[model samples]
Target: MDASDGHADREWRLIREEAWPGPMNMALDEIAAETAAAGGPRTLRVYRWEPRTLSLGYHQDPDTVDWDHCEREGVGVTRRPTGGGGIYHDSHGDVSYTIVAPADELPGDLVESYHELCAPILDAFERMGVPARFAETERPARHQPACYLRELHPAHDVVVETDGEERKVSGNAQHRRTDAVVQHGSLTYAVNAERHLAVFADASVTPAAFRERVTGIADHADVSRSEAVGALEAALADWADATEGSWTGDELERARDRASEKYASDEWTRRRPGRR
Candidate 1:
């Protein structure tokens, strides 16, 4: 976790995980939230994967994906606690953010909360020289197979211009627990359009058909990942009273245990709704 502005006393913790499986990532966020409620600090975790993975949304069906394709390709798969759709995180194109904060710290309404968290991403795009905006209209139902595909009520859903045409640069989702809110999302830097198309063949638009609908910093703005990260830090700073901090060993242990027991369990992953 890199601190850009040096505001080092506002109860913020930065965690940069070295690419674990999908379940571990979700587990860490859950643990971080619980620990924060128990006097742990507000946290921002930025991470990537060694082997790429697919994360399905909480209400999404594992059967919706071509699991055999993923298995044959050795792609790691796990379900998110948040609602939306599925996302394929390949190494080159995606950057994931998990922001954990006390419920009181977030906006009261769900849409407002989404806008508040996504402020930094919008700022980052502008800093990179891309004029980005959030779509004010209601999100289309046709874009629901993936989070990026759908522009819901409050997502930042970074929109950028190309030859006067608008498209999406990034997308995100949120999960609210009693004490905390977890907002997780990905910024598309470069997309494997074909792979996404293959995964969501039943969707209205195939990745190949809507390649033009997506935008990325590499495609439009001349910026490095480090620059994007700097912009993100600045954007987050605008909304947060940040501080420098780390987790205790016990916290990590608890997160690991939860990852194994809850996030990694097939009963949790494959369970059907209303069908105990």
Candidate 2:
């Protein structure tokens, strides 16, 4: 790997942006990792949720969710393969992406891998005129139920300064296996404070508090959602020196089956792994 150029020894694929329901989105990420481990091209995918979705962290307690609120608001719920806190993904307000490659292709150390994979995301934010960077210091957790409100780490948490305070703009997490790794994250393109808070069981976290803690790209930059997503897609493609690609019909069918069998099931989404 050369530092001066984006090209590397391994081939890469950029699966152009697509939209799917929450369950399908999670299933596809799992499929991507599996394929990459089995000698498929290293993949970078950008996608959107068809409807608003609440994605809970792998280990997050299901008790923290307000099921009725999510139902009344027409919000779909699913659990991510990566661990963190819950995220209320607004269809138009959140830009999500995933990177999948063989474990040996990325750095063996966790922090180093995050920095390498997230470099393009930082570049994308700069392209949007948002001035985003990893948090310089860790912040105390203000809430336990949401990803943005959790304590910030310099490893992968991205922040932007607004009103002289560094507020979070994106959150990234990874799920590693023996053969491959999947890193995915959410960039807050715009904030829907009311709807974001409504999905959680905690009423103490007010909309104003949520706004103060999290900032979006649209908060400081005058870019539309499409432009923001475009910047990310271009940055990611250049980062991996990737060629344009799309899902095979077989991949889509497998993902659909996984979605129905796993992500969409209450048994998987509601139960904490390894616990009754």
Candidate 3:
């Protein structure tokens, strides 16, 4: 289906406002993808991280993580199934989302697929009165270890122009398998630079530098985190023509099992993608 089509022509399941630990969040997304691949309903969900969390990209170097700092600060750590640099998801400072459907149902080209899936994200920003769009040009990386600070690409990076410069507000990536695709991302509603930086092993990235490279919904719009979440949830639902929904008991059980086996396991988190 064309992503720009009105809700009258499409259907999806909407899961909103759930909060879970990092490992469970990742597992749930995986389960959602599996469900879609198995002829189940497509999903659009917005969720939060409890205790905040630092999520490493699928291929991100484990050595770039500051394990001691994360433990000391009570920040949970997990690895995403998608690829990108690390992202620090704050409990109240960020919003997270996932979209899952059969791979054949979306665009065939990778970048085009991102554009199609990210339509609701741009609409969400519009609903919150933030003028955000996909970046039109590439920007050099300010820091390679962080998703927001890495090189900006027009493919999936969302930005708002401020003071004549485009500052990143969101980063998204996709994990495509033979039968399905799962697209997930983090959008900043507020910045916690100190905590964000402390998750990385690099100590040279100052908060001022981070502020220059990244931005949040609160930066350009006077919207609270709760307000932002509401707008985003509404946007995703409208975009997908989705109905209010919840996980089935079996799905939740499967996600819990997957979390224990993969996301929460040291063998899965500490090694590179294929190693585990």
Tens digits of per-residue lDDT, candidate 1, 45-73, equal 76675467778778876666776777788
What would the per-residue lDDT of candidate 3 be over residues 165-239, giving only the tens digit for each residue?
A: 889999999999889899999999998888789899997999999999899999889888899999999999888
Clashing pairs in 2: none
| TM-score of every candidate relative to the true structure | 0.86, 0.96, 0.96
CA displacement after TM-score superposition, residue 225 of candidate 1 (Å): 2.8
Between candidates 1 and 2, name the one with more favorable TM-score.
Answer: 2
Can you tell me which runs of candidate 2 are displaced by over 4 Å? Answer: 1-7, 273-276
Which regions of candidate 1 are displaced past 4 Å? 1-9, 151-155, 163-165, 201-205, 237-241, 273-276
Model 2, range 79-153, lDDT digits (tens) per residue?
Answer: 998888999997688999999999987899999999999989999999999989999988888888899999999
lDDT of 3: 0.90
Judge candidate 2 at residue 222 and give its lDDT.
97
* Candidate 3 clashing pairs, residues 3+ apart or interchain: none
